[model samples]
Target: MEMNIIETINRFPDQSSCIAYLEGLRWQNEPECPYCKSKRSSKRHETYRHQCHGCNRSYSVLVGTIFESTKLPLTQWFLAISLILNAKKGLSARQLSRDLGVNRKTGWYLQMRIRKAMQEGEDVSLFKGIVEIDETYIGGKKANHSKKKRQARRDNKLQITGYQDKQPVIGLLERDGRIRLQVVDKAHGVTIKPIIEKTVSKDATIVTDGFGGYAGLSKIFREHQVLNKDKEQYARGKYHTNTIEGFWTLLKRGIYGQYHKISARYLQSYLDEFTFKYNHRDNRLIFDVLINKIAAVT
Candidate 1:
């Protein structure tokens, strides 16, 4: 679908049109009973609800999806989904509040629910190709309460410790195909090595920077190369981590520029959201693809 598809969707301002659209997506052949999965079902008082002939249970098209329990108009829900996927840097709850013309709390709740839908599954296969690995720290402002005392007072400030305080992000870029990102536990060898084994194929070439953690991954990867930035070697012949470095640039921009400061607890969801967008950059209908995920089961 094109951007104009959203305009057409806008024409359907009523709930009936929204229900029909959702029905088409939820069921391809016939409107089967969501409860019993029976083809024999009857409409309830011309409403969206349907009754199963076998078990006599009633169900709406949204019973099993993320749309369950939401009271907003289906049209507004679709509009919100489209706006979210169309925006490049991602949207905040306050921004959605103003745009959707809903109360700030409602918008916040809606965005959080949508974020839940964006989360990637754990059992999904890891990325494979010339995968590049890296990590970064994310934390909010530091208080300058007492700017007294000697010896570089800035150094005395409490640095956030553990992967819990600072988000441990690892990115795997598959040459030109797709990028897989995860919030790791730590930057240590034990934490990072297992991820490398899972994501990259044994025959794939792996590129990373000079980190002691990634030292031994060369044995597993077909050709592992390191670009020691301190030694002034960012690239050696065809070996470099620039591709993943470029991804880090986009991620930091989204974090610092757009969202400002995402809490460590919810950092992974945000990373998955960005990674989903990055991997599908080439798809012209990315908005549609992501919206489908909301309807998709785990």
Candidate 2:
């Protein structure tokens, strides 16, 4: 069945139904023992247990998968994955906990596990052609009590520092293709250069805003085009960081509107979820893709 939250609940009403779904996706009829990778197995008992004849070991289909040691019902996990994947912006742990009837920490943990599957490393594939690169900050305002406190102050107060209490995130997006995002410690030539070198192809033309951090990018790539936002110049011909900036809008809306706030610790996971969704925007089998990715994590 096509998996929505309702469909997940209705289709997988029990643990066995959920297990069947997992087995269908992972094993495809031939159940294998995860410990020994032996296909000789039988459905001997409950919890989808399989007796491996080759290894003489008993294991469930969930073994080594994300649902291996789960205390919650597999139904809930399927629903959560469905909800998280379908949400265009993102889903909050708090809201997810309420929906799943679990504790906030459990909901957060569930999200982290799914995000791990969605994660794409720098080695996935290189961006080619006119790739747009940009750096943005993620965080709330700083506190007024003390300069060191880092607490967000009043909304109307004049800002002393431009990027106080914020984390720097760099993005490299291929024109009408995939995007790679990273949470960097800083946005400077030394920090940004290495990332660009690894993620983008040297033959591709790079487009970005006139940020000092991108100082030496021209020397590395075939061409580095700059859009001076400071001078009211944004795009000319095929030269603009608009595509990436447009992606930033979806990301920011997801962060600010859906999540409201995110910590530096788990920010990368949020980025992973967003990047995965954005990259596969046109994929009709997105739900299945997410499920496959989750299975691959094993």
Candidate 3:
């Protein structure tokens, strides 16, 4: 069955249900005191506080968590997370505020906190088999420009400018499999090559455009197929960068439509969020993963 906001509400309707669920996820067996790590804990039998028999102190489940010291209802927080997970393209703070019936400032803070919970990244092993790598730029358009000039600006924005002044993103995708993306400082050989080596298995075949930076990768990989886009030859046999290029389309749409304008400093966090969601696209456990993120941060 699909896990929806209603299911979350049904599963955790109140503060007590929220506490029980969080305690279950945080502590598999006996509940320990968060302050002293004592196993001698007793339920306050009052509100959402837990009492430690050893330390003689009371604590709520929200202590030291992302939800700590928050006055909003847990139902609202769960609804916010649900909205974030359900919206494939992402939602603006104003949209969230309207949907949740909350103030715009509260909605903004809620979204930022949810993004913090979404900032979980684990060690992903290198991509094996055929890997495609590419890059793209992200920014908004300005007004007062003619239609032809706007089109030209859009065209110029597609080129993968090195990571200096703008956000230079690098995408590596295993053919018919998972993908990895990162914001980099530059696209030069020194910067891109090590990333390729670290993220791709040594024996995997690599494909890219005829960028001189990718010159020496063939010595390490089984094959380094460079489809020179300048020469107008996009593919030869099974060599192409369509997978990684496809990621750029979704990313650009999300940035332009959802975020509007992303600061260069915080671009990678959004990139991580997109990568996490996309990597787990096929898994029905995405909500579970998001919950785990909350458990970690909280």
Candidate 4:
């Protein structure tokens, strides 16, 4: 079962409990040397570190994982992980800092480290079985809708072209299964088609709104379903893109509501976080699922 905030705190009340949890999950028998991958190791006296006989080195369960080099206590790290995983709309770094009694900088670093583990590989398996594809533009909150901000941006010569001001993000969701999200330079066929081809399988049927970018998809995939909203024909049979659109609503609420502002440089990482949570929303052990993911990440 997923661990709630209180349960998470109770489970790892101290640093030693957190270390023991990691040790049990990372190794079944004796602790293995991360450097040499050998099980020949002994616990250091009065310390969590272990001595490896194979490489003549010392290590801990935190070695090479997301917790590596972190100065924060293991209990706090575990609590942060639990908080992040439990936040459906996402918990901001400032809020985390306030919650954990840490400064904003440390909270930001902690979040960024955890987010790094959420990244998805580009070569992950294709999405089959009725896929829904869509694109949306994300950016700051209308430049705060303030004339002063707008004037400042204009004085600095910032982009004012409505959609151009925002970053284009494409989402391809496999109906009731997994979803893939990517930030792209354009919503045109040139940039989007390649992503569709690589991320989606040829056998899967594709559904999308009436976007010119997806015009060529009919030829590449086995079947393409389009809902020409221009004619107000939405859901002609099962061709609607409602599923992915609903997902967009959630993502936008999280980014625009929870985060408020996200730099384009790190936009994809934010996408990865949303994707991870969405993909595992159904799992009863979602907290444990994220923990396992953290265990595998370096």
Top candidate by lDDT: 4
Candidates in order: C-alpha RMSD to true structure: 3.7, 3.6, 4.9, 2.3
Estimate the TM-score of every prediction.
Answer: 0.86, 0.89, 0.84, 0.92
- Model 1 per-residue lDDT tens digits across residues 1-298: 3344357376567888877766776675367776667889888997788888988998887887767877888877777766666667777777878888899898877767776776666666656667777777766544412344222444777543343345677777887877777777777889878877876779898888888988888787788888889989988886777888877877787787867888777787777777777777888776557566765543
lDDT of 1 at 217: 82
lDDT of 1 at 44: 91
Q: Each candidate: what lDDT? A: 0.73, 0.84, 0.78, 0.86
What candidate 1 gets wrong by more than 4 Å, as runs, is 1-12, 122-126, 141-165
**Residue 274, candidate 4: alpha-carbon lDDT:** 91
TM-score (C-alpha) between model 3 and the true structure: 0.84
* Candidate 3 positional error at 126, Å: 2.4
Residue pairs that clash (backbone atoms under 3 angstroms), model 3? 65-298
Q: Which candidate number maximizes TM-score? A: 4
Q: Which tens-of-lDDT digit does each residue in 1-298 have in candidate 4? A: 3578899888889998888777777785458888989898889999999999999999988888899888899888888888898899999999999999999999998888888877766757889989999999998657465798788778999866678568999999998899989999878889999999998999999999888999988888999998888898879776678899899999999998889989989899889889988888888787776666677633
Q: Report lDDT (Cα) of residue 232, candidate 2.
A: 91
Clashes of 4: 0
> How many clashing residue pairs appear in each of the predictions shown?
0, 2, 1, 0
Residue-wise C-alpha lDDT for candidate 2, range 54-114, written one tens digit per residue: 8899888777777878899888888898888888889999999999999999999999988
